[model samples]
Target: MIEDILSINQRPKMDEVEGVLFCLLNMLFYNDQKKTVETEQISIALGKDFVISFQEDAHRDVFDLLRSRLNMSNSKIRQRTADYLLYSMLDLIVDNYFIVMERLGEQIEMVEEEVIRRSNTKSLARINQLRKELIVLKRNLAPVRDLISGIIRSESDLLDDRTTKYFKDVYDHIMQAYDLGENYRDIVTGMQDLYINNVNLKLNEVMKVMAIVTCLLAPATVIGGIFGMNFEVIPYAHHKWGFYFAVGCMLIIPIWMLWVFRRRGWF
Candidate 1:
């Protein structure tokens, strides 16, 4: 079990040996400096008289509140058995899940607004990144849900009957986190589809503009072709105003088409 804690990419789980209860969980915390979520392996052992916890990082922890409660003489944690201490620690870890989720939720909301306002390549990239982060969160959370369930059903004598209620509360929290992760996954997927539709809409607008320009130029092309024909005799070919007449038609036709289009609100 110690070696499991030292290993990379350890999945969250629980085990019992003799009378001791062991729990391995992947803890997530937001790194404010790096603007990303970081995972840490946490191993907890609950024995008859004491509870031991092992953390990968010595500098960071979510256990300050637990320590403070332990120091209080009138605290329920100080009055309870080691099983309650174990529950307290697990509760702290699960509570931090809410905090991390809140941070990611804000990011998800921002990316969602970007997608709806005017999606660009940058918005698509942000959506992809958010998807990956949510996947990481789901990856860590799903197993922890199972691990908590296992603990609730275990027959370990180290766990007190009274403390089981506290663990059940923790179980509820883990289940809530799992559901939130699933909802975020669905939202990200919808955002991805919306982004694609927005891109297609933009492309269709460009095509529409190109088609209108081609139509407006069609009359000029037809008149020029007719006037440029190689013929010994042609109507208005020798007229003094022939050049001005052709130029005026070219200008007038496009302007007239523009006015018609504007009246009909086509562009």
Candidate 2:
């Protein structure tokens, strides 16, 4: 095997890339802590009768299966031209897209349940993260689709005419990824709205409870204020058990209100 390497300054640099499909790789991955989706990039370059792949990390690559297949003498990949090999690489990447998307779907369902059961800030943060991830998925995949289409139309001599047909399939897979990202985003946003409504409902219930308690104790406040007056005459002011009666009244008022609330199912 032979390899050609270019230094950073020797290779062409991109200042800005907006949705250029060929220049980007998009993958949806589940985050263990946040349980959200994230994107990983892989770059592939086609050369004379060979392809060179670039991965950010040295530890793992999406091309392991392809590498193994290349070792098999009877494999179609060996029999086919270099362009077919390129298609095989792209197909594997798209297959991974489906796998990661399935995992993301499961994560979304879990977040939806937690949103309903808890509706706390943490759940809100999780769904928000999901939305952000979906956005990134769209941003990355759409341009990749366009770039494939561009390559198909530009008729670049690098890609054989026979291999170009396979790229159309790759473009179709990209569209599917694009649409899935959008749908997941909508689902996440809906979950967010549900979370907000639930949290607000909880706040309102707490407020209602406090208001009821205040109302029930209002009579006690009045009773104490009246007895505190400097006036010579006040109801129960002269009774021997007046203190006990006043306390009894305070207790009874709250109990009655509580019973009323129970009857109405307010609590």
Candidate 3:
């Protein structure tokens, strides 16, 4: 449904009025300006007797609820002035912002649980993605907060004191959502730090084990190197049981090293 908000300014010129009425009735118009509808600015102006809404896009309107209220036989909108209608529409938009925030909050909670339960690479990647989404959401919401604040403080006759209070409430919700997003960002950062520390600890453990193994083999390697030399003066070289003697040395050296390591609590 289309909602026509007549401005309290001058009535349209006779020639222009027919075209305006035609566009309003047809609900579609072919104009060069219409091509920029999605990127156009939207503004609502309130005058003593009427409300004027300027939309860049002629195809999209933000008055669905207003239209439904207006259709009701005993609707309060019918008895209210244009200012009320404009305020109502603004309220609806602000309400939708909260709805979006609610959904985002739910998603963030799920991500938080995942981060806590598992700090793997996949979880880290998901946290990064959530951080990016929060950044975008914050960017969109910051301006909206400023805009609502402007409306609340503006001297527009369209919004009564009660409506101003409502805007303030909406602003508070926006602030809360912003805070939540920031807190989640911090939590994700902390999770990343934790994951790094865990990986580093595991690496240190493996290195310690390798160092112990190298130390335990040091004596055996030294014995083998001496026996492998072709020198004739080496002890036990001429013995008939020389091979068995070297084998015994190899076994005993490791056992002795292990006993020393145990005594020193190296293991």
Candidate 4:
């Protein structure tokens, strides 16, 4: 059992062996200052007389509030059986899942605003990162939900009948968290689509400007080509105002095109 808890590749599950109930659970915590999600594994064993828990990270955990409650002489946890203590621990872990979801929601809102105000490479990268994080969240959530359900349905003598209702409550919380994860995944996908469309719109605007400039230069090129031809019969080639006529055509034609464009609302 210790080896299973120490394994990095272990997934959330439940087992009962020779009257001992073993639970391997995943815990998710949100770091607000760093805008990051932290994951850890918690292994719990419920024997006839005692409840033992092992955590992967000793530096941080979501069990502080539970510990404070345990220190109280009149605490309900003190008056309960080992199964109730196990339920309390699992309940705390599930509650933190809600906190992680709330943090992720805030990040999605910020990314949505960034997508709208200015969709740049940085925004795209952040969107991808959020998608990846959501995937991790979802992947762990389903198994934990199943693990809880298994525990609730188990017929082990170690689990107290009175504590079953508390496990059911935790089950409801996990279900809600799963639903919220699905909604957030859809929102992130929509944000990515919005980002792509914004990039395309900007490109189209640049191309439109380039097209208008090209059209205005067409007249100058035609007039110069005609007058510079080797043909001796070219019109206005011998006039005193020939140079001025060509230059004036170059300026006048572009102005005329600009006026036509504005009148038609092309720009």
Q: Which candidate is the best by lDDT?
A: 4
Per-residue CA lDDT of model 1 for 95-195, tens digit only, reads 99999999888888998999899999999988888888888898889998998899899878888888889889999999999999899889999999999
Residue 163, candidate 2: C-alpha displacement in angstroms:
3.1
Instruction: Rank all candidate structures by their TM-score, best first, as comma-separated numbers.
Output: 1, 4, 2, 3
In terms of lDDT, which candidate is stronger, 1 or 3? Answer: 1
TM-scores for every predicted model? 0.93, 0.77, 0.63, 0.93
Candidate 2 on 119-161: residue-level lDDT in tens? 8889988887777767656666666676667667754555688
The TM-score between candidate 4 and the true structure equals 0.93
Whose TM-score is higher: candidate 1's or candidate 3's? 1
Flag the better candidate by TM-score, 1 or 2: 1
- TM-score, cand. 2 vs. native: 0.77
* 125-180 per-residue lDDT for model 3 (tens digits): 76676566556555555665666666666665445676666667767876776676
lDDT of 1 at 205: 97
Please say which candidate is ahead in lDDT: 3 or 4: 4
Best by TM-score: 1
How accurate locally, in lDDT, is each candidate? 0.89, 0.72, 0.59, 0.91
Task: Locate the minimum summed-lDDT window of 10 residues in model 2.
Answer: 7-16
| Ten residues in sequence with the least summed lDDT for candidate 1 | 26-35
* Clashing pairs for predicted structure model 2, backbone only: 19-143, 21-143, 21-144
> What are the per-model numbers of colliding residue pairs?
0, 3, 0, 0
User: Which of candidates 1 and 4 is the stronger one according to TM-score?
Assistant: 1
Give one digit per residue, the lDDT tens place, for model 4 in 146-222: 99999999999998888899999999999999999999999999999999999999999999999999999999999
